[model samples]
Target: MKNLDYGVIGNCRTAALVSKEGSIDWLCLPDFDSPSVFTRLLDEEKGGSFAFLVSGEYVVTQTYLGNTNILSTRFEAPEGAFTVLDYMPRYRTSEKSHYLPPEVHRYLRVLYGKPKMRILYDPKMNYAGEEAVHTVFPNYIRTSSAVDAEDKIYLYSSVNFDVILSGEEFTLTDHQFFLLSYNQKLVAIDENRVLLDYERTKVYWLNWINRSREYRQYGDMVNRSMLVLKLMSYQHSGAMLAAVTTSLPESIGETRNWDYRFCWLRDASMSIDTLLHMKHQGTAERFIGFIKRILKSREDTFQIMYGIRGERELTEEILSHLAGYENSYPVRIGNAAYNQLQNDSLGYLMDVIYKYYLYFPGTLDEVEEIWEVVRNMVRMVLKSWRSPDQSIWEFRTRELNFVFSKVMSWVALDRASLIAELLHKDNYAELWRKEANGIKEEIHEKGWNEELQCFTQAYENTDHDSSLLLMQFYDFIDARDERYVKTVKAIKENLFHNGLMYRYKAEDDFGKPTSSFTICTFWLIEALFVIGETDQAREIFESMITYSNHVGLYSEDLDFETKRQLGNFPQAYSHLAFINTATLLSEEKKLSRFIRP
Candidate 1:
């Protein structure tokens, strides 16, 4: 039903994965964290799908509509060619403003071809728990579940066709028109309104892309990555999802599936820093404000992740009823990592605030209200720097004093002290600065192993992890440092294989990892450049970008032997790493110089 050979289209509020066969196999209505309206990605039979399938053999090619999120897929046959235009509506405020309403929850698909096609519109409501109750009309159909009568899904067509319903199936043939609206009134098909929506979406994306400070040397690969980040960004609250879908297996047909629909503080912080580096400001400010509101409400602690609307206590559970994606078991919904004590969130938060100050410089007043929150976070880091944490990997088996966690504990204090001095709120500046140095000294002493000559995954052992390479990113240490150089070489010898990288090779709760993490590979690329291995770094960079899907999209991990994408689709962490590495490695601009103290 659904395969890896697919592309994504969304309006930020919700997204869908469309197969190259012109079928929508995965989508959730209303919001990113909502229950799937079309669950075929997880279950091929019991789950639902909307497909525009051609009967005969054809060659397929897919791409976005120039710079916009509108995806255009073309199929060529011996007799004729077919095209599908798919997009989610995002109406802008005006020709001048870059604003859109939060409730533009509609999926629009238009079919254009001379070939005879088959339409299988199988929609299961409530993630297959409730079958859709459909009432056919003259030219439209209304589908909703028995559980929710008021809310509905309306499918209105633009062409002349009659729906044939047989039991649980609805089949429509010889039609090239489409309109799929959710949580809105179904009205008559307005050609002018559709044209206007498409134009506004195109204009909005083009306007946003025009502001990118990216090097044009990389061309579409870079811009498409930028567009992917924007597409993954939730327009209502500006909480960017780590990926569009969840429960995609990491090792394939295994139980490593986890939900990634929510936002991680680390992922969002890194994304905002990259956005600022690209000279884009709105999304960055909005996401920071999202985190600020969370911290402001709670004040005592920060969680690793949260729902897009800031819902807490994400209790994860498996859907035993529905089959998993491609028969992979345990399709999980909520994320249990929300309960984890990933202290790096505070460090990355402070890092973004400092980066914001570096670029805008005049936004000190905006951050003034949150200064107390920063103070509380720094005190928290100071108190728990020595404590073991679940850390970024969210290890389920054991909690250790991860070196990455400690380094970021240092990063939190480092950025807070700088922010305090920059804003002339020098009350605790010296105190934070002194503590940051203490943490750094301790890391050099304890985190490094004498025999391995590389930074260990934790302070207790010599197991190497690529996340330690993030030391270069945090400015915890520079590449020219002898210890840092040796650490890179150690990782190369231990963890790296065939130009790909793994987070660690040690035993885990789920046995040992068998795939290369895509984000870790990007980290290695940046680390290589920092060590002045420019030629090897460039080669790795060029080779790694090819691991993306047909449309230049990446998942969370890659199969080391097969080179196939794994984990969730269109991962924000992977794309964010790509953007950050691209900007840092760009020859035209030396912006990495600005990140250091």
Candidate 2:
């Protein structure tokens, strides 16, 4: 009965997906990649969950605690109304220590007002494959799997209630507080400590949100986007994950599930662009550090993605034991895309560096210091630009010279030339500029379809590509180019349905897509603005955000037939694209208003 239409709460170290009915359906303890303690999101029964249900009929509403990652759910029942405040502890570090080690993060639930509740607490460790042992204490209960004693949890209550040892069930007659923790080692529960823990965690998140500078016009949307990005970020290594939970399908009943818990360099680079634009310079700097620290050792090479801690070699495998989400089979954990030859990574990475240099040229140490890695990346691009590999869409079919990839290849060299010029390497800069021009010329000749009067998906193909809209955002293509106008017209003619735009209409590994990608439409909005269709751009931009869920979040795709979100929850690409498109739209609207008089 539970679904992903839920609010997410996290302390950067870990996150919990709590459904509207007050159930913690998905949570990975200790870290993002850690074994899930509650994962009913993937499977209903065997995948354990923590739920506190009202005894009688109730109307449920859910939201976050005012600009913080703390989630709250209100249950208004016939008997009475009660609210549950849920959060993972994230108190600021003590001035005494330079770094704080992972403490026992308490998932505290404080009930306000009195409502008879039934507790269903089940802990299935390691995909329900490992057996965990529970020991009862006077005021608390501690649990640790027999296989991994190092990771333990303590469950304590603020008030005693009727407890059934069978299935860890409890019956509550009144409101009370409970703490589920892996960091605290104490046996007795403390009410004052629970209250302080909640306050400290709330304050920490608010402080983090307060760090962002002014976001004018659509500040609320920007705030929500920034917070969602922050919630998906891994605190320990500063690696930004593509999404919080993985294996959510891009299409229901299809084998499109992918684990996005690891850090995709492409996604991270795109995220940095958004964060820096939103005045979250600290996050941008940290991610830059994560990349420099991770990729510095490798010579003339990069990956599509890496584990949160910069781990290489993410072997693709199936978790046959666990039933997939919606019974969609073959739940995967590690991503196989890590092995693909995604040459676009170089372009995205260089784009991030170029952004950093442009924003804080005098202060960005990473841009200047990581030149060795930068030089090697340029060399990699020059070597691999002509070869066919997995492009950004990451199709399981054979690779082609995707026009989007070629456009980004042009981006790589263009940025490399600019960076080289900034660093005063005239010869190197000129060489990259010359190479960039060649790629541009090749794209003009081969990547474009003359008869169709627009850019195509790949060389020699006439498939309508939504990614063609992206060419306008980059310098490789001018927005006013007749080819650009024809590309938009071609997509509107072939790929659009109602108000939404599909990524592509051609059948590929997954057959024809049944939904419009949220990010691609955002690209369309940006292109509309660029081509002086400001009125239509604003309308589309405003309407597209309405597709997001109740908490202003989006998945990778939304079903074209039913208008349901169909991919990973809280997708970074969609949100980042939203921020970018919204900002541009707002700016254009202001300009239009100013010029009207």
By lDDT, the best candidate is 1
Q: What alpha-carbon RMSD in Å does predicted model 1 have with respect to the real structure?
A: 3.0
Number of backbone-clashing residue pairs for each candidate, in the order shown: 0, 1
lDDT of 2 by residue, 304-337 (tens): 8999999988887888878888987778888888
User: What local lDDT score does residue 269 receive in model 2, on the 0 to 100 scale?
Assistant: 86
Q: List the residue pairs that clash in candidate 1.
A: none
Q: Please report the candidate that would top TM-score against the real structure.
A: 1
Total clashes for model 2: 1
lDDT score at residue 173, model 2, on the 0-100 scale: 49
Candidate 2: Cα lDDT at 466: 88
Q: What C-alpha RMSD separates each model from the true structure?
A: 3.0, 3.8
Candidate 1 Cα deviation (angstroms), residue 505: 0.3
